[model samples]
Target: MPSSVEPARPAGHHTPGPPGPAPATPPSGDGSRVIPFGRRTTRTGRGRRTPQPPQPERVVAPDSPQQRLALDVEAWFLAHQATLTDEAAAHVYRTTLDFLQLMLTSSHAEERLSPDEYQHLTGMMQVLRDAPDTL
Candidate 1:
């Protein structure tokens, strides 16, 4: 049998020939580089699932007080509903803004009020509404 090893070539001509398969990667334009080995693998079966584009995030309207307030109320209602029954949360959400003027005047209306304070006032209203039956 022939020897397993081939005699070594002289320097500068020692590069081995191709191992008999076409390269998996497309050739680069310059041909000056071959992609490093093991960077890709061939799949034998069905192709990979292409990733889906992400759904766009829900964006709050900028610089609009009404939109911001509506979104805040919606978010608050969702959170409140998690702790309380749906009917109670709905009642609070509907009636909370009904007393906005009263809350503003009571909370020192000379200065600006925050959305959170308004939400707090609504929560107080919810408590007050339930207090009568509890007594």
Candidate 2:
């Protein structure tokens, strides 16, 4: 078998690479950006399920106060991910936001969120809402 390691390159050598995707936000002093990787992986299945007409639909008006609040909460967490308790909480918050999206678009929000998880989500949102600068 060949060696497992690659031969070292000269110090002055530079390899061209594709420009990476734009950062969601400006990098901080550490040159790191926060990414919301939870938006997609939170939901998994054979495929998306359509709502059954027989089930009652929960309507959340796009401009309604609750919807507005949810939007604000999401934006805040996305911008302030570094301040969150941990990466898992940030992921869970994204999952919670996705659940809210399901509530608005389908009759199936309860399937992904448990009572305790929702309670924690709401508690975090409530803290943000209670902040002096929250809208």
Candidate 3:
């Protein structure tokens, strides 16, 4: 009895013509496709793209020294908002703001803080001033 098997093609050999059509249905004039999810269209597709609710804008403090200090402290806090959860971080923010308030009121603001405190406060001030540029 003869074997009912065909010889295999050698490696790198292929019987080729134009490749088969795409697995996906092509889009129509209205941009619809016959997908399993249903008749999907670019404009009329039923998906989870609901409109987002608008958030209320934060009111900025005024330009006076005290207000400016508070805004700087707040901006620094917001930038590092994740740090707020730590008790030590919260204490640092509170202490820095309090000292900043006192220092801003003095005629010699620079003299009021130790060198390290003054440098930290200046860094926070820079953060607030540069916020618009960064964002």
State the C-alpha lDDT per candidate: 0.53, 0.54, 0.55
lDDT of 1 by residue, 19-106 (tens): 6776688567755343344635477557778789998864545645444444555566467554223566556544654566476656
Worst 10 residues of 3 by lDDT: 126-135
lDDT of 3 by residue, 6-81 (tens): 6755755643423677547555664433233554567765766888899866544457554565556557767976
Worst 10 residues of 2 by lDDT: 126-135
**Candidate 2 C-alpha lDDT tens digits along 1-135:** 224387855765644433777657666764433233444565676688978779655666668666666566666766975423355655665566567654633432534666666566666555543322222
**Top-lDDT structure, candidate number:** 3
TM-score of each: 0.24, 0.23, 0.22
* Between candidates 1 and 2, the lDDT winner: 2
Residue pairs whose backbone atoms clash in candidate 2: none
Pairs clashing within candidate 3: none
| Cα misplacement distance, residue 37 of candidate 3 (Å) | 66
lDDT of 2 at 71: 62
> Which residues of candidate 1, in runs, are more than 4 Å off?
1-42, 45-47, 71-135
lDDT of 3 at 78: 76
